[model samples]
Target: MVVVAQQTPSGPSPLSVDELVSALELRTSWTLMRVALRSEKLPIGLGWKDLKANASETHSIAMKLRSFLRDYFEESVVTGERYVQIYEIDKALVATIVNACKAVVIPASPFSSKYPLPLNVNLLATAPSDPTLCDVRNHQNGDISFIFCSAGYYDDKNSYEYGQLPTHVQQTYVGIDKLVTVRKNYYQSYDVITLRTALDRLEISVDQPGRLGSLRFEARPMEILSACALHFQSLQGFGACPPENLFPAIAEMYGDHAAGKVVALAFRTMTGSVKRERMTTNDDDLRDERFHHAGMIAVGQDIKPYEIELDMEFTAPGGIAGVKLAGMMSQLASANPTLHGCYIKAHQFIAMEKALNRLMTFI
Candidate 1:
């Protein structure tokens, strides 16, 4: 059941449950609910008329139903991650919390038959436990196979995009199809050490590099997860999405075995964010110590030269060709002077597919 606020010429006003019922039943302009239990389908204790009434019992049931539905968002089924009170209502209303506006469906059944069939046996056992597996598990071949599917809306058409993930991180990560400008005032620039600090706080792991860009240490399970989460958050504004909790939940369910397998899968896949830009700055504001990048990095005077460092040890999945193409474009922008704009085109599914393929390879 949806509780909608009544709107006036000026703005929306707080509404009672009875008013929400009136709006829903009458299909009034105040109705914002797109889905609700029909009158006939109401639970045993409640009916359409009961919801419509202004009586105490009506309000009581309405509140109870609302509360009951709200509970759905409180606990994660797979990981048991509970939503904080601030986002409780909003989280419960949406299907999957990851990028609410993007309509990325993180499957409920994990056993539904859809596209992207025939998972690899190795990946199935290695994939972090989640409902996402439902899409592949229901298929006849899924017993020995696990599949991960990511769909994207480009312009308006849907297409399959995939990613290649790191071999050792046991997490699922996906990027949105849009670019999000980071709020310069809200966050400080983070280097590898600071980034690791944040990951440790969240109980995530990352590969322990002996030095910057060095592979002396194996990947930290949490650090890889953090990079995936941050990449997703940067590409798409935060909402009810739950990808952040995916890896940890798998760790809890299967203990170290799950964790180890996931990390291996991540490194093997090298899942990272990639985008195309027809591009690109950083300013160190003293008091607040915030970093700001302006225009395109290609044209911007504040462009950091160090970003060009290419540690090619990690292989990008989806396909080598696409990864190489993007890398080439980035290099071209950095070296060429007369180039006006650079176009970097990447499909989001590439990341998802890469992660899935690595999971399959490991399992």
Candidate 2:
């Protein structure tokens, strides 16, 4: 597991975001990543704040929320890079939470901004993943997850602006540099040995406040909150669940093991490779002869979105499907067109009948 520093631009930093982007060779584009839910149809009474996943991919509640959302969140009509995590909540419930009585959020996104008021529960919790893999005990009594996207979701590396998404963190990472800072007293380097030592010396108590929050996992405050929103959106998908039972389900996912590893990976180098090593120095040396600055850290290749997977298909080697599953695969072909092959989602494949449904020819 890679360990990077939780570097946030406060007053001023040594290395600049542009410099980091250039050094890391980051793919500079406005791509809106995804976080999926395990259900059918969108949640109810939810309103649209921006554009839907697909213009053709519908969401009925959006149309209904138009007028009401005007007061809460103003839709984005500008131009530039932005992103959207596919989820929202019941408008009535949201109204109640914001207007009537702010129900006690035992905890929002564990990494929410400290400066902000109303305690914006930033990071959305992810759930309904491979049930076999769930750590029920850890996440059972209330857990939070941030894995917001599934491999099948599409990402356009060129669309700086998401039709309806407001202008937000133009990129998943403010810059590749922010993530690669895994060294101590060194906020902008990727020295493997330094990282190993740093993690060893680091002490994080989930029971303690402010440690993880200071180690932010996402770019902007709202983006993280958007993540927290995705969790509620997923709850809406669990059909027919009585409110009595829902609270327990919510608690179970809170204590998940994701808090530790997921965060490290989010800031990991795109290729899992480090550039420069952190300058090693003794405690006395630091107090005596100051150490090197972040500007000196060496940069490596681009750091793509974490857990980004493409859903595609190919032919068997002997001319079955018509694709050679070989070589390095970075991205996908244009929308609707399989990169020289056909593709089907696992769910779609399972839903297909073993035999074809013969249609009658009515001439």
Candidate 3:
């Protein structure tokens, strides 16, 4: 039988995140053309034709890059074992790297602008060709995703004001562009390089206090965060983990085999308004607290809030429902009351947990 690797007290021979970063940076061209092509946002457009073309190009590049990166990461993770022969990236070290990766993300979408078109135009076009006929289609169809109608546009301030695409279309375009970036970065090789570099810098920052706050993973609002987690896991070599136990579990998995590693956990500690008179405010004081804490986590903060409510789920590596990942939510909740106080519907918990699990797998 093959023997597994172990860590020594000296810190697994010291993997240099800085060195890895230097290696990647030296070879990388973060210039406009490269970044745009890698981000798949190249060849900007103003009209529907150009926008459609951009979207098509994004899809094409995304598919190709995603396939290649999947294989690359698989090799990286499997070969991670070999790295240990010379130097092992400790679990805490890996955690720090991932946390750094969570920082410095910008939207890759080109479409978030407003679209200006009348909803009824499609109806008018479809109606019997009468010069006096005016399309009566619902202009807000695109605005509301479910409000689908025949081909059309929405007349909204966003698009009209910008002298560009309507609000809905702009939003959709930007949203799609961002999605394409997420798809490529999380699922493709170039994106993997960025992630690895981020992780490397993260570990270096951890070691060097002067750089502490430099590589921060911005917090995605709850809904987006959940979605992003799932998206990250879709990359080829990524695996899933239980939502609640994801961080700690992955921390352990990437930890040293011989000796336990020290993960540099950092996040801003919060202070909430506790006065009795302020409780009457309509703002969700408790929800706000939870939201803030989640943000801290996104940036790799190790914070304990006064109150919290955790909604989590678990699954097998392949996205199958298995044992529910438990314990951490309650444990963290005990540490932060805000976590314990939040209310998540049962179904929402199940769905979010699955989503979180899927995300962890991809990361």
Candidate 4:
């Protein structure tokens, strides 16, 4: 019998790949031009009309304009030194010039056959809110509860998904489809006003640390913390986790410390913690507390008659406060069996924050 060989799946043809790369490059150039024009607030002249009028010319007007800008910028200099020179026409001006060139080169309709790639026409457009995407319920006590459900959960009998979602949402349905896969299992709700107030407090604290003492925690702290966790996830790449799972996980980790009292969470670098340590001669000097801890203190009766206050602290061992938090949680879980749940929650939060910070740099 003739030996039969196993067949492997075929990849895209080279021509197809080349076409995609070319299309993507063109799209990227157009996107950069649009961003530059909007950011610099550059004025568009009658360049397009002039180009159309000179369509019969042997040499295109667009090519002539581009050549002129290149020569002008190359010869211009603001400061000349032996080793270094600064251009008189800065990056912003160069961007403006490039955008002007694009006005002549690119057609007004981005969907034209000249550029085969799909153009994001609404890249700078202000998105309209979709009421159906989120459900907001108002309580008699004037507190509003908000629940953002994945669009897939509300699919019609015909299996057609949320037609009303924004165009971008429709394009990435494959990825978003996973988010609503188990929507019911992880569905969670939050008090809208309370959440907003907590975020406002966070913003103020970041701006003015001296005013931290005056900040109020009247709203549910879990709502605020959960929102932070969600923001962290969105910035990072954990977009797959549904709100239902994310909120409950946050509540379980820090909920006990935050419950029935005002709680403030802060990160300190490992170097700062080490500098604070006292010099000890003995080898057995108690190792500095490297895990989560809480203490209670009496803050007087004017503070809503609460008998005691909770001060929650977490120690990390690196220069970056976020990294230290992650390391501390790992050490805690390994050393103490009792704090396994707390470690899980804290680990997730720090990991999310790190991911978010990475994502911000790209933006």
lDDT of 2 at 126: 32
Cα lDDT of model 4 by residue, 1-363, tens digit? 111121111222122222332332322223323332233343323443332233223354533433322221111110000010011223443343333322222112312222122223232122211111122223233322232211111112223345655677677774453223322111111112111221111110011111112222222223233433342332233222222111122222223432212122322233322112221322221122222221111212111110111122232521111111111222322332121011101112222223223212221
Scanning candidate 1 in windows of ten residues, the lowest lDDT window is: 76-85
Candidates ranked by TM-score:
3, 1, 2, 4
Clashing pairs in 4: 186-244
Error of 3 at 157 (Å): 17
Candidate 1: tens digits of C-alpha lDDT, residues 288-315? 2122123222343222221111101113
- Per-residue lDDT of 76-107 in model 3, one digit per residue for the tens? 21111000000113356445434443442333
Q: Which 10 successive residues of model 2 have the least lDDT summed? A: 354-363
Regions of model 4 farther than 4 Å from truth: 1-134, 152-363
Q: State the lDDT at 181 in candidate 4.
A: 33
| Position 178, candidate 2: lDDT | 27
- TM-score per model over all chains: 0.16, 0.16, 0.17, 0.15
RMSD of 1: 25.5
- Give the candidate number with the greatest TM-score: 3
Candidate 2 has a TM-score of 0.16
Report every candidate's CA lDDT.
Answer: 0.24, 0.20, 0.24, 0.23
